[model samples]
Target: MPEPQQLEAYFALTEAVSLLQHQVEQQLRAEGGISTVQFQILMALNGAGQLTMTQLADGVVYSRSGLTYQAGLLEKAGLVTRGPSPEDERATLVAITPKGRDTVAKVLPGHIEVTRRLLYEAVPAADLRRLRDIMSRVRDHIREEPPRSAAPRRRRTS
Candidate 1:
C-alpha cells in the first residue's frame, strides 16, 4: 500500500483530473458538438496526420472497441475516415478530415481558455513549472509498462 501522504496526493490528483475533464467535456460538447474522447482522437490525428487503430487506442488510452465506436461517429459526421492500412492488411488507419481540422480549430481557443481559467488561474505562477515537471515525470514513469494495445485479448465465454 502507498504511504498516507502518497495516497492523499493520488486521490487529490484523480479528483482534480475528473473535475477538469468534466468541464472540458462540457465545453467540447457545447462548442464543437464533440465528446472529449472524440476531441482526443481529432487532436491526435491533427498532430500526426494519421495513425493505426492500435496506435490511436494506445495514444488515447482508450479501449479498442470504444475507439472504434467513436471513430464511427466521427466518420458519420464527415469529420474522419477509416481505411485499411496499406502497410498492414490487418491494421486499420484513421485520418482526420478537413471538417475535423476545422472543428478542432473552432474549439481550440475555448479549450485553451478553459484550461487556463480553470486550472492555471488557480495555481501559483511559481508552482506551474514545478507542477508540469512533476506530472511529466509521473507520466513517463507510469508509461514504462507496455501500452494497452500490446495486451492479449481474453477468450469470450458463452
Candidate 2:
C-alpha cells in the first residue's frame, strides 16, 4: 500500500479536479443549457474558428468518433456547421455559427468567475504560483519520458 501521506495527496488532488469539473458542468448546464462536453466542443471551435474533426477531438480530449456525434448534436442545435475540408475532402471541419459565438460570449464570463472562485479564492497567491510551477514541471517531465512500449528491452533478443 502507498504511504498515508501519498494516498492523502492523491485523493486530495482527485477530489479537487472532480469538484472543479462538477462546478463547471452545473454552471454550463443551468445557464447555457449544454453539457460540459458540448460546451468544450463549442469553446474549441469558437477559439479556433474552424478545425478538422480530429483536431476538435484532440483539443477537447474526446475520441474522434465521440466528437463526431457531439458535432452532429451541435449542428442540429444550429450552433455549428461541419463541412468537407477544403484542404482535404476526406476530412471534415467544424466551425461555430453566429449563434454559437453568442452563446460562448454569454457563458465565458460566468465560467471564468466560477473558476476564479474555486481556485484563486481558495488559495494564497504565492501558493497558486507555486502550484502552477509544480504542475508545469510535472507535465514537462511526463512529456520527456518515452512511451512505455518504446522503453529499451532488458534482455538480448535471439
Candidate 3:
C-alpha cells in the first residue's frame, strides 16, 4: 500500500486531470463542435500533415475502431479526409482539410486561454516547472508499455 501522502497525491493528480479534461471537452464541443478525442486527432494531423491510421491510433492512444469512427465523423463534417497511402496499399492515410485547419485555428485560442486560466493560474512558476518535470517523467514511465497500435484486437462474437 502507498503511504497516506502518496495516495493523496495520486488522488489529487487524477481528480485534477479529470476536471481539466471536462473543461477542455466542454470548450471543444462549444467552440468547435468536436469532442476532445476528435480535437486530438485533428491536432495530430495538423501537426504531422498526414499520418497512417496506425500512426493516428498510436499517437492519440485511442483504439483503432474508435479512431475510425471519429475519423469518419470528421470526414463527414468536412474537417478531414481519408485515403489510401501511396507507399503502402495496406495503410489508410488521414489528413486535415482546409476547413479542419480553419476550425483548429478558430478553436485554438480559447483552448489556450482555458488551459492557461485553469492550469497555469493556479500554480506558481517554480511549482509549474517541477510539475512539468514530474509529469514528463511519469508519462515516460507509463509509456514504457507497448503502444496501442501493437495491442491485440478483440475477437468478434458470433
> For residues 34-138, what per-residue lDDT tens digits would candidate 2 score against the true structure?
888999989888888988887776557666557788899999989999999988988898999999998888888889999999988999999999999988998
lDDT (0 to 1) per candidate: 0.95, 0.85, 0.95
Kindly report which residue stretches of model 1 are placed more than 4 angstroms away from their true locations once superposed.
Answer: none
After TM-score superposition, the amount by which residue 55's alpha carbon in candidate 2 deviates from its true location, in angstroms, is 0.9
Better of 2 and 3 by lDDT: 3
In model 2, which regions exceed 4 Å deviation?
Answer: 139-158
TM per prediction: 0.96, 0.82, 0.95
Cα miss at 84, model 1 (Å)? Answer: 1.0
Question: What is the overall TM-score of model 3 with all chains considered together?
Answer: 0.95
Clashes, model 2? 0
RMSD of each: 1.0, 6.3, 1.2
Q: Which digits, one per residue and each the tens of the lDDT, describe model 1 over residues 1-158?
A: 89999999999999999999999999999999999999999999999989999999999999988999999999999999999999999999999999999999999999999999999999998899999999999989988989988989888999
User: Count of backbone clashes for each model?
Assistant: 0, 0, 0
Question: Which RMSD does model 2 reach against the true structure?
Answer: 6.3
Model 3, range 1-158, lDDT digits (tens) per residue? 89999999999999999999999999999999999999999999999988999999988999999999999999999999999999999999999999999999989998999999999999999999999999999989888999988988789999
Compared with the true structure, model 2 gives a TM-score of 0.82
